[model samples]
Every structure is written in C-alpha cells, then in structure tokens.
Target: MLNAAETRCDALIVLADVDHVIHVPLPNFTFQRSIDLQGILKSFLRKALVERTGQIERWDRGTWESFLSPLWKCVVEPVMDALAFSTPGDLSRIFWCPTGPFVFLPIHAAGLYDTKYSAPGHKVFDFVVSSYVPTLSILAPSRNIYVAHNDDFRLLAVRQPPTDGRRLSRLPGVHTELKHIKEVITNSGSACATFLEPSVGTVEEVLGLMNEADWVHFACHGIQDAKNPIDSGLCLANERRLKISDIIGLSRSRGGLAFLSACQTATGDEGLSDEAIHIAAGMLFAGYAGVIGTMWSISDTLAPIVARDMYEHLFRNGTRPDYREAAWALHEAIGRVRESGEVSFNEWVPFIHVGL
Candidate 1:
C-alpha cells in the first residue's frame, strides 16, 4: 500500500458509483452527480473504443462530440478543481488508480475538445505526467532494489511474422525497430540477442531466453481475451500464442523490464479492469520491475519511431546507458512525437509506462 506520508502527489482521485472521493492526505468531499456516473463512464469508454477501432459508423462524430461535455463535467472537471484548490503548488505527476469502468477511460487524455481551450498548456498532459498501477502494493517490492547504472545488460528482442488467418497487420517496422535497438545496445558494448520471424520467434523459444535477459522487447501482435484474461497472449510466428499464464509460470527472480510493443498489452478485461489482469501487469506478476505497453492499437509506422527515440533516450544518456528511468524516457519520446505533428491520438496516447 502507498504510504500517505511518502505520497508525492497533491491528491489521489478515487472514483465510485454515484460520486468520486478526492483523497488529499485525508478523504475530502465527494463530488456527487444526479446521473449514474458509472454507466456514463462505461458508455463513453465503449464509444471511444468504437471510434478507435474504426467502427464509428454506429455513432456519428456529433454524438461522440456530445458525450465529451458530460464526461468532463461529471468526471474530470471536479477532480481538476479539487486538485487545484487543495494542492500546495503546481501539479507535476498524477498517479490515477481508477476502478471498474473508470479504468477504461483515458484519464491522461482528458480535456475539453473545443479548439478555444485545446491549446498546448490547457490540457491534462500539460499539467502532469500520468502513471498507473493496479494497486499500490505492487510498488513496494520495486522500491527495495537499487537501480544501478550498469551497461553490462542483456536484451532479448522478439519479432513475429505475419500469421495466416490472423487479423493482425504486418509490421514492417519491427525489422527497423529491432535493428535500431541492436545497434544502440551493441554500440554501447552491451549484449543483444534477437528472435526474428519464421524460426526463432516462438512461445517456447522466447520463454527460454526470458530468464537470462535484462530486458525483453516483444514487437508483435497482442490479443486481449475478455472472457479469459490468462488466455490473452502475444501472437508469434507459426501461429504460436504466448499467454499470460505462460509468463506468470516463469521461475525467474524479480528483476529487469519488458517492452510490449503490441496492441492492448496494457488493456485489461473490462470485467476485471480493477485487477489489472492484462499482459503488462502479467509481466509484473512474472517479476519484471518495469513495463512499457500500449492501451489500444498503435500505428505500425510510428511504433518504430517511438521505440527508437525511447531507446536512444534510455540507453544513450551521455556515456552511461541507464534503463532505470523508463517512464521519463517514454514521456520525452511521446512529447517529441507529439511536437513533430506527424501522428496524433491513436499513435501517441496509447503508449504508456507501467510498473517502475
């Protein structure tokens, strides 16, 4: 559990059915709504997902536009006001531990969509860098380990081939991504091993190498099984699927990091969203100290760019390569992409860092 004394935030936003409680060192006043806030949140999430998945025909852009006002009024605005009024200084980082349907909402991307108030300094991302955890207890063990600056680390990169009968689009960028990562790590005099298509990229092969790796990067397709969370897995070569159960069963000690550059790797089952039973959390449960993942689908072209920038920032800090600051590195990478104006929401917002 988080120590109230050691908490770095101004306040913690805890959502409930009819109202949300803002915890600013103590349980503060609740924001009440006449409507069923939970139902509204779920509806908003469903609409967002539909638009994200290109199924927006069911609801027009106007309808989607209409939903945002209630979302901001009922869910976001109250929390923002509470933090601004109660907090001592400027807000920098926010750790949103959402529950139930609220978990599916993109709290980091919350903003007024109108162009009048949609400037760079007017949004949530401008206020703070957001980090999420299923529960605060998972943070306890990671605090014990010292993140030493060691360049003698080993990396395992896996890139799956386009499987037949699978809906996954082929990621040609995986080749560029792996190549860039290899060049970066090896140029730093670190060990880098890869399992590329057709032969080496399999569930069995990747699992075999995971224990010895200081970091593991999976550049493939991720499937989220809403019915059975454990069965949700990464699609690899020859139609092989590496499930969450396979990852949790590893006997390795608690250490290292995982970069799941796949779709929905951080998205848990809607039915069990509070449990954080997704592939990203599964990696943590499998003993990884840090994880970088996507909340929804990401662009194939932009994935390599983001990955390249992130690794460059992470592994090439002056002379000493440090992977300990994964979250900061990712935040910078996303900022760079956003500033470039090449890609927007689906490409940038989906990428998130969990764990340490």
Candidate 2:
C-alpha cells in the first residue's frame, strides 16, 4: 500500500476537533451535535478519500469500512440518515471540512484561544471570504488570496435578538462604540478598497467592484439554512439570498480579499458544523487564498465599527501580532468608547473569529 504522503492525491480530508467539539449550538437552533460530526464525514470525508486513494491504492472496502465503521455508526451514518429526511433544499445547509489531499482546517471551536493542533497540515496558499469580516489573518497566517462573495450580517451589526450573558461578554458596546472605531480606519486610508452595496445588487456588480482591489469588504446580512448548511446565503436588501454558487463563480474569475460583514457569513448555523467552515469552506474550496468569518450573532449597529477598526489595524500593522492581539485591538477600541461614556460597557464583545 502506498504511504499517506507518498500517494499523490487529487484531494484531502481534514478532521477538525479530533480532540472534541462542543457540537451544541447556543440555543434556538435545530442542528444536533451527534449529527454534525456524522454529516461531516459522510458529506466530505468519503468523497475526498476516494478521490485521493482512487488513483493509486485499490481501496479495501472491508478495511476502509472497518476503519470508518466506528465513526459511521457512532457518527457518520446517523447524521446522514437524519439529513436524508431533510427536503431537497435542506441538505444544502449541511457542511463539512473535507480531508485528504485537499487541506483540512479543523479549529477547536471551544478552544480557539488555547494552543492546540488546530492549524492545517499543509502550507496555505490563499485567503477567501464572503464579506468584509475581521480576524482572518489572526486565525491563520498561511492564506494570501482572500475572496468575498456577498455580505455577512455578523460583519455589519454587533448584536441580534436573543442576546444572553455570553453574547454580552464578548461585545459590550457594539453599536455606537463600534461605529467610532470604523471612523478611524476609513479616514486613515488603511483600506486598499471598500465596497458598499446600495440596497440591491448582483453577483456581477460584486465581481466588478471586487476587481478593483486586493481586499474586498461588504457590509451586509447573511442568511443561514440551519438544516441545509450549504443552502445558507447572503441576505441582499432586494430580499434575495446570495448562494455559494454565486461566490464560486466570482472566485473563478478573480482573486484577492473577500470580507463578509453579514450575519452567519462565516459561522455555520446551529446543528451544523462548527468553526464557520460551511461558508468560509466554500470560499476556500472555490480557490480563494483565505477567508475570515464570525462565530455567533452580532449587534447590527456595532459590527461595522469593529470591522473597520480591525481592518485598519491589520492593513497598517500587518497580520502578525497573534490572534489575541487582533481581538484586543478591537476590544480596546470598543473599551475607549465606553470610557468616554458615549455608551455603557455592557454592550461589547459579540463578534468572534469564525475562520482562517
């Protein structure tokens, strides 16, 4: 049998959270933890393995089956069966980080701040995005070619409904405080280019506008299909959902930075996969350099403010200060607003990094 590295492959499979992932959503979500892992392997693992192993090794169905059987029974098969009952469009919301020749990035969702084996196994070559999201570089230094497809609400608003104690701790002064931060970045000229959609627009418009610069930023909303993760999309003001297909088309034609400042742009819906892999994964899969995404719901008014500040810091300072540094910069900036008494300190810390 050919060795893992020796076998030239067409793709790869990366398993995130080999250690453990919470698998549970915050609340008011439908995706189940047990199904999330199973769905990941079935939707992503099986095919990637076949693609890579197909060319050289004669797959031992029995051996492979035995190896995966435990995961299948304990993980894959169950999720696949559960998802099978889902409607045609429903499966689209399910997502997984494929492993094998293709790169697999599995972030320990709960342990992001902790030092662990979370980075990918290969040398990353690009960056991808759906909207103008902050903290991509901090997640991984390897990506270079970022891509942005539409808008992400998490990038725009700092808070959403059903806010709780955990949400409040992450972002205290999300509205006015965040806006103040954006003021510094926009006027500083730190951004190479910015794209602001006026109500309604098309993928073509985004593609054309994206062509103008190395970094792409969109302050908009993103819709997530909790059941079918892939079906998740950007919520355009025109009341349309920008699907991943639109993003793939755009990435095929150009390359640069893509930021999604919309809700769930990077973060997968509950019961779906963790690490915002579904959305950002599409950008990476479509051949972008890197993608940055958000973890949970955000404060609408405050999102732009934090996003603007984050970009300015990264663009001017460069993305080398470490993850916490980026988080701190944004955190501190928001803190200043609170100190100034423009807003209370209870409204900061909602937005979090969703991807690399």
Task: Give me the candidate number with maximum TM-score.
Answer: 1
Q: Model 1, 1-356: lDDT tens per residue?
A: 11112223124565323265555432221223212443554464455532122222233434434444454444455556665633322446556665555556566655565556655544556566667777776556444374554655677788857545346556667888788887777676545555555565667777888887778899888888889999998877776899999999887767677999887898878678668799988998888877898877777777888888888877774344444577777878898887786665546767887776
- How well does model 1 score by local distance difference test? 0.66
TM values, all candidates: 0.77, 0.43
Candidate 2 residues lying further than 4 Å off, grouped into runs, are 1-186, 189-194, 252-256, 269-277, 317-350, 354-356
Per-residue lDDT of 160-190 in model 2, one digit per residue for the tens? 1222333112223333443553564455543
Best by lDDT: 1
- The global C-alpha lDDT for each of the candidates, from Candidate 1 onward, is 0.66, 0.37
Deviating ranges (above 4 Å) for candidate 1: 1-91, 118-120, 141-144, 149-151, 165-167, 195-198, 318-323
Worst 10 residues of 1 by lDDT: 1-10
lDDT (Cα, 0-100) at 123 in candidate 1: 51
